[model samples]
Target: MKYWNLKKINQSAFEKTGIVPRSMSKLFNRFKQELNPNAEVEALEEFKVAKYQTSTSIKYIIVLLITPILINQLSKISVLDPLVNHLWNKNSNYIFLNPSQEERAFADLQRFEEKLHFEILIGKLDALSAENVNNKMSNKALAIALEYSQESVNAIKNIIADFISIIIFVSIIITNKRQFSILKSFINELIYGLSDTAKAFLIILFTDIFVGFHSPHGWEIVIEAILRHFGLPESRDFIFIFISTFPVILDTIFKYWIFRYLNKISPSAVATYHNMNE
Candidate 1:
């Protein structure tokens, strides 16, 4: 009596209908298995680490394009302008002259006093009232204070822009890392395991699913849901801040899970792939 071969029978079916049917069956099986926490964890551990190792030159280019926009938007915050102006006013000095002519006269006297006492006086004069000494100090102090205020405002704006840029840069990195992980998993199961002809056919299907789900527009809904959950205000600054920083938070959590759990099951594979180049 001849024994039947199950593997041969499956190969025959795969040959007859092509890899599409087999791939579809495998896809569904994987999907079902992924529904289980244990199976999902195991699958993540087995995920192809090599596929994700590549240059991030394109990612850096993307960051360069995006960081400027984030900085520009952050610089436009209304609060910054008012804070700068208010600080400028508070830190600046101004003489309170009663009449317009007296103000002009005080200005002339200030110039004369500065020219005459250039070598003698070491400090500025405060509150140059008509009855007070014409010590040219008020004008010098006002000029110095105004200069300092301008410098301080510019410094603050630069600091804030730099901070926002850093946040945006980190967010972009995290987003790219997550995308690489997804691509690796898809390639491992769908492309690496298939014949060349099967890979060609399935690549179209995979590309459609990957592009559709990974579009930035899809993130808007998730961002909105999170904002509503936290009862955050819907102001422009709040919205922009969320748009800039939320991806970093979300991707960090995802990477944390993969490293924390997946690393335990496949220690060697995980260790070798980390800090991968480009």
Candidate 2:
């Protein structure tokens, strides 16, 4: 039997369409376990399982939080930063991932030029020829180049650090298989054990954030941020396509899970969700 199916018997009373004989058998078994003389032993075993789940969960969280930051700092101190900068700086086009970055660079230079003009207008500086303006713009362009190079190097560091973190994350989950199973079961129980009203509220909240009408706008912003973080081109077409298709697919899968699993496991919660949604 599946490990998560262990709670099936306990929730048999909540089943709206079960055979009488099977229901009686489940009741008898529940009564036997509750009235058993080894109740203390059972309680102690459950406590041990919960302890393992807690420790494993904490380890997971710590690894996720610490590993990437540690790796990033170490890379900056090591040869990683110099090597990436050398390779990246060799290509002039690599300085900016997309035209938006170039536009922002020019905008900053324009602002600096405007400030210089304002200073001259207030008689705070001597009048400048066109050559002086060109020279200042050239210096600003060089500064922008150095800044973009640093950004690209940081993006490379982020990619390496995140990849290593994920490897460690998977290794931990694999090594602590039993504890992972316990944690998974514990989370499932916690969610499914919520009161019907609480369940309905959570369902609405999650759906609104992830699959609601406004979610596409949020998704667009997130996609743009992720692309910019990795020094990738921010393509509007790609963002729009993903926002259109991915959320629809996610919504469909969510509905399928509710119908196939949640409906069978807790029909009352499903009913509550429907009523609240309407």
lDDT of 1 by residue, 1-278 (tens): 01122222223323333334444666787888878769955555434232222223335555656776767566747556677567656845532212332344456656766664554454454434543444345665556445444544655555566567677767765777644443344434443455544433443343333333353455566665543333333354565566566656665664574456434433333343443311
Q: Model 1 segments beyond 4 Å from truth?
A: 1-59, 65-79, 87-137, 178-278
Residue pairs in candidate 1 whose N, alpha carbon or C atoms collide under 3 angstroms: 54-278, 55-278, 56-278, 125-137
lDDT of 2 at 99: 79
> What are the per-model C-alpha RMSD values against the true structure?
19.8, 5.5
Candidates in order, TM-scores: namely: 0.28, 0.75
The model with the greatest lDDT is 2
Score residue 63 of candidate 2 by CA lDDT: 65
Q: List the candidate 2 regions with Cα displacement exceeding 4 Å.
A: 1-34, 89-94, 98-100, 107-132
lDDT of 2 by residue, 96-201 (tens): 7667677777888889889989998999989989899789878988998878767767777677766776776677678866546555655665676687789889
Candidate 1 C-alpha error for residue 7, in Å: 29
